[model samples]
Target: MGTKTALITGANSGLGLATAKALAQRSFDLVLLCRSDQKGREAQADVQKANPAVTVDYFIADLADLDSVREAAGQITAKYPQLDVLINNAGYTPARLEFVDGIEKSFYASHIGHFVLTNHLLGSLKAAGAGANGPARVISLSSAAYLGGRAARFFRKIDDLSPTFAYCDDKLANLLFARELARQTAGQGVVSYSVHPGAVRTRFGADTPGFLGKVFSLAGPLMRTPEKGAQTSVFLASAPMKSIGERNNGGYFADSAPKNTHNRDINDEKAAWLWEKTMPFV
Candidate 1:
């Protein structure tokens, strides 16, 4: 690849859009994925206008729909010989229990959907990693809410799911997915990391039900701006591998630093389990 490429999910707005701007500023060609085509093109133009030298492309894909994710990934891998960065940043919380292809809707949006996309693009990521600017990076956006994650094994059926609870559990799944990807791809020149982009006030959870939704809607004044929240993501996308440290592979990061947390649920065992449990879906 003449210039590095980054593929980001939910890139039409919020943290994803902000991250795309930052990466474009750093001269990376962007392949943005969004559910709405109009917003995707608008964001693409925003990034392209800001950094005229870089390429900004968009694909319309709903993470809730497995077929859509796969179709988008197919185009991406077909067009790009290698992908230098993959930001699994798309996330959403349904107001109540819902399903797409028999899986929980929020869980599908936050985890399984990205799972399929990443699986499809793994080849391109590995190709980039093994090349000159070796070790392609996979960055998943998680949240501190992961601490409250249920670890319910997302594939299982739950009679009811609160928006808040769904978010927490799915966030944990983000970390596990990253860790498992790192382990399976070890020594393959691809690295995975999960990030907690602190409570950036975005419309991401506008539809969240009840008290949590109220907090997200009213707490905008206290929350970090999208640009500020995207800093760690930009750092992870552009930093030297040595600076990130190889030991910290499959790490979780917040505030631009690796979080060596004591959370037992965020361990390799759980990561492996999640991988195995979700493999059939992919």
Candidate 2:
């Protein structure tokens, strides 16, 4: 039998690439997605070269654009029926406010695009669930910033949206979305999880403010490596974890262990409300 197949988005660099490497090391077939074709191809080559026996493929999908998301999801679904894992790891933290299709910037890329792509790939994940190994999992990356002190207070209201609190709000949306998705897919062999990778050294913060971005830029020594950053994400998707019923279905994880989420509003009702509000755009 072939090794299980796993698809990771934003796989050109950072946590996504590191996760790909970890999975390849375990002999999992890889499908890597990136916004740029050139970069995606390069990442694919790098992975394949590292593990000559593993199969690594690449797809181009700009999570910032809904059309690209849909097309990429469709392509993946058409080609692969049983996806053992789906890692929604792509993100964009723009320095300046930007909008796509009239929606806020961070909200669109971090939450809406992943939601749409996950929904589109639901059938394939379900197919994988039917196999002997039980259900397939969908792992979405959240952030410790979701509960980052007073800065988190700004994201209490989902309707009170803006560009400044864009990343914070979107991460909150990720938690809410994961909860509701777990509810909707209950007993279907498809479970959803949101995770915080901790404060890692990555290019994910290349667009932050003056000293902050610079300090984040030079964080290789002070912060965890990308492989360490990907531990919880990969574990949520592939680890033979402990009991995970509906109570923990949409649960959030950190440091490769389940942690109590500080975001109290990430319940079913809130997820449903946010879903209704953004359903039209996604």
Candidate 3:
């Protein structure tokens, strides 16, 4: 049998790296996609050392830049020709608000880039096929922060992206994208799902506000380690979508279990809107 291929973005550290390690342990060949050249080199060495038998490849691309994402997708598709799994784990959170191509940073990196890359590489993922067993899978990393407690009540408007609000919007966007992707790719033998990897002790929360950032930082003692955090991502990668319910077809999971996705705006209409708006840039 041919070795299965798995590509993980931001695989240099934290949840992405941990997931890479787990996949390596499973003996799957790896394609580690990172924006940082130095970190990618270090991770290549580390993963190679740990899983000497598995072929590991590296590609560098900043997902926020559409050109970079397209280039990366073209290169990966040309080289690998067959891709079994795609984990969209790369993200950007700034201490101060930022934008890429005039859109919110979180929206650009978390949703737009991955959205385009998936489309660009859709053929390769299809080439891998479902076979008799199952199809290639795509795991998109969302965040629990989008659940917004009661604060979500005020999120009815798209213009409400004040400060941290954009992050929530983007995370919700992930769920919407996954759902539409499932519908679009149904029976094509390629599945896509979104996930909240639990609030692991990672650098993600460092840019958050006030006591929240500190509290998140201090969670090193209590929060799930990166390995534990990445289990659901791995599960989505390897598990059969049907067993997890229809929700798994285009829904959200947390900690390896199905969960109620948080937004009514995440309906088909909104997803189509996002897709149309993004088609030009992708």
TM-score of 3: 0.89
Taking the tens digit of each residue's C-alpha lDDT, what string does model 1 give over 184-249? 999998999999999898888887778779989998899999999999999999999888888988
If both were scored by TM-score, which would come out higher, candidate 1 or candidate 2?
1
- Each model's C-alpha lDDT? 0.87, 0.78, 0.78
Report the lDDT tens digits of candidate 2 across residue range 1-282: 237888998899999999998888878889998989899989998878667788898888877788998999889999988898899888666576566656666767888888888888999999998887658888888787665323233224344443335666667777777778788888898888988887788777777765446656787578888889999887776777464444578888887767787756665677787777656755
Off by over 4 Å in 3: 130-133, 149-161, 209-212, 240-247
Best by lDDT: 1
Off by over 4 Å in 2: 148-164, 210-220, 243-247
lDDT of candidate 2 at residue 174, scale 0 to 100:
77
**What would the TM-scores of all predictions be?**
0.96, 0.89, 0.89
Cα TM-score of candidate 2: 0.89
lDDT, model 1: 0.87
CA shift at 188, candidate 3, in angstroms? Answer: 1.1
Residue 119 deviation, candidate 1, in Å? 0.8
Compose the digit string of candidate 3's lDDT tens values, residues 138-216.
8888888666422232224334355455666677777777878888888897888889988787776677765556667
